[model samples]
Target: MRFEVLILGSSSATPIYGRHPTAQLININEQLYLLDCGEGTQVQLIKYGIRSNRIKHIFISHLHGDHYLGLIGLISSMHLVGRKEELHIYGPPALQEIIDLHFLHSQTVLRYPLLFHPTQDQTGESILENEHILVSSFPLDHRIACTGFRFDEKKRMPTIDRTKTEAIGIPTAYLPLIKRGNDYTASDGTVYRWQELTLPPPIPRSYAYCSDTVMTERYLPFIQGVDLLYHEATFLHDMLNRAVETFHTTARQAGQIATKVQARKLLIGHYSARYKDLKPLLEESKSIFPNTDLALEGNWYNV
Candidate 1:
């Protein structure tokens, strides 16, 4: 299964240093999920060659303008493009009202169905699940009600050894059961072991997205052991006090979180406008968590 995150924009409250706002496109098994629609997200989608129509689910972390200012525009564009599929939005309860108010004032009616799923504050709950993937939300420490998302690929069935099965004279009709780890009994009363006919499935991979939040341990368990973790680093350690006051995180703090959670790799972004050069932030983060990488726009990080 193919799983990767495409960074669309990576900036904090304001866009600076050539960085846009916060947005990401997560592609899991060819299905696209939009995470946080910050300003100019539509333009970034176009620039990155990601088809907007492919995105059926949008996740908003908070009500902050920098985190979700581009949502209405993107939805409007989808309607203009004649998209007929249902659009599922997962966010705070107020998000539905905000979208409805915008459409009411603009006299714009979407041609497709709009479904909203609100995340429960202060809770880590499963939001959606299918055969291929599962999505869950956990509360984050921020100025307002905010949440982080975890996307996990489901465990796959083992592959059947076609040559071994054929040589053993197993019927083709029993291949599906063998792949599911089931033993087959022929009419002659011969039992075929599943272990001898199939190979073990690969380990499932997961990715977590933590938007603007203050340093806290509350969300650690939800993101533990993820293959890739994207955490907001709005400032450097020098502005620790400012980060606390604004309910944001520093690069060093982000590294600490990634380390504590035992994440395979950390991708840090949501840079403050004050940072014209992000080398210092990266260096500071790497000093603590050597596996950290700066979340650069247009880059794809495989999970």
Candidate 2:
């Protein structure tokens, strides 16, 4: 039930001002998912006390060096550490080739199986799913083929009222039906409504990650209503032209996007190295969206 994100790094392009590049670890229901293994991510993982072996899935937004330059090293470390569990990686189509070439030249055969999933640059699509969560990848406006990820918790079954059920002599066989919101019929032909036997299920939670992308309306629908949103704000509003030219978003624009999506919380990061102090960027974002938080390195944001 622990759903949180640990930001490993927050700088953009290069490490500076005590910040590393872009890397994040999202933990949901005890499973780990790595987002964008930028340079020094392995070291950051160690510094943060996160077990790298727990990372079964890695999602790369693009081929940008600051976004995923540390991937090969991480994968290689997993091999050296004797990892046997299969690892799944999702990213642009060319990512597999890049990883393959790295391993080929290094003459490294992974100790575990490696699977690559290519994200479609066209639209939002469900790329991974399990009983507890569903992960979808959506295209983002960027200079290269970039995409964002949405993590949504699955709908849970209604909580059964054990006291009511027992008092009504409801059989164990009917529990599943009750949880599914179906009325249960007794042997005497009496009907017990599901509402009378159970409480409503908790609302599902969701998180969205958008990094290395430009401010565009196309991503609005995909990220709407997320409990927590991590959007890149690589520059301040004063550098708007530079941000636009580089296909990156400014702090002010990032906050506006969060407001438009009606997100509960917005975490802005991927700061430009030129910014030794992020106060100005944070202030600009908060002016538009008051619920914004700076995505600082080693910080954990719960959803």
Candidate 3:
């Protein structure tokens, strides 16, 4: 199973010449999960050759226009394309009202079932779970009610050693038990231990998405030890005062958070439009956390 994050847009509230608003797509196994749907996100998805239909769940961090303005268009497009699969949307309470108003005014009936899960910014809890993965949301410091998400892949079952099983003449019907780390007892009282026929499962992988947050360490516990962390770095060190005033994070601040959390790799984005070049931001972040990278649009990072 592979987990990857594709950067769709990286700019902050204002749009730039080549950059769009904030958006990211997390591909876990074969399912697509969208982080934030910024303006022109659908176009970016199409440009990157990502089939929007594959995205079953969408997570919105806040109610900012730059973070969620593209949602209505994306949902409308899905209906236009005749999507019949049920879609699950997770976001703050305001999101439900926004979508309801849009659909009510347009009188557009959705062709597929839509499930809305409203998130309260005060609580940190597991919001979604499946057999293969789990998703949790934690509060973040921002101007508005906001949260960050963590995606954890469930531990896999131990692999059966075919050679050992064949040599032992174990029945194939008992292979499931062996993979589950269970021991089998034969009719003659011979016991077959699972350890002798199976190998340990690989370590599970995890990724965290923190968007539009200020310099706050409260999220460290939730994001600690993530395989890959995508955090917003809207400004450079020189603009730390402005970052604080606007309740946004500087590049160095983001790096510090990543370091404190002991993340394996850090990707920084949601850049301020004033920056014509992002090399300074990238260098600033890498200075504190050596494993930091600039979140460029259309770039894919494997977790």
Query: What alpha-carbon RMSD in Å does predicted model 1 have with respect to the real structure?
Result: 1.2
> What lDDT tens digits, residue by residue, belong to model 3 across residues 26-45?
98888999999998999999
Per-candidate TM equals 0.97, 0.96, 0.97
C-alpha lDDT of all candidate models, in order = 0.93, 0.93, 0.92
Provide backbone clash counts, one per model: 0, 0, 0
Task: Sort all candidates by TM-score, best to worst.
Answer: 1, 3, 2
**Best-to-worst ranking by lDDT:** 2, 1, 3
Q: State the displacement of the C-alpha of residue 198, model 2, in Å, after optimal TM-score superposition.
A: 1.1
Scanning candidate 1 in windows of ten residues, the lowest lDDT window is: 178-187
lDDT-wise, the better of 1 and 3 is 1
Q: What does candidate 2's lDDT look like per residue over 91-135, in tens digits?
A: 998999999999889899898999999888798999999988999
What is the Cα-based lDDT of residue 238 in candidate 2? Answer: 92
- Residue 244 error for model 2, in Å? 0.8
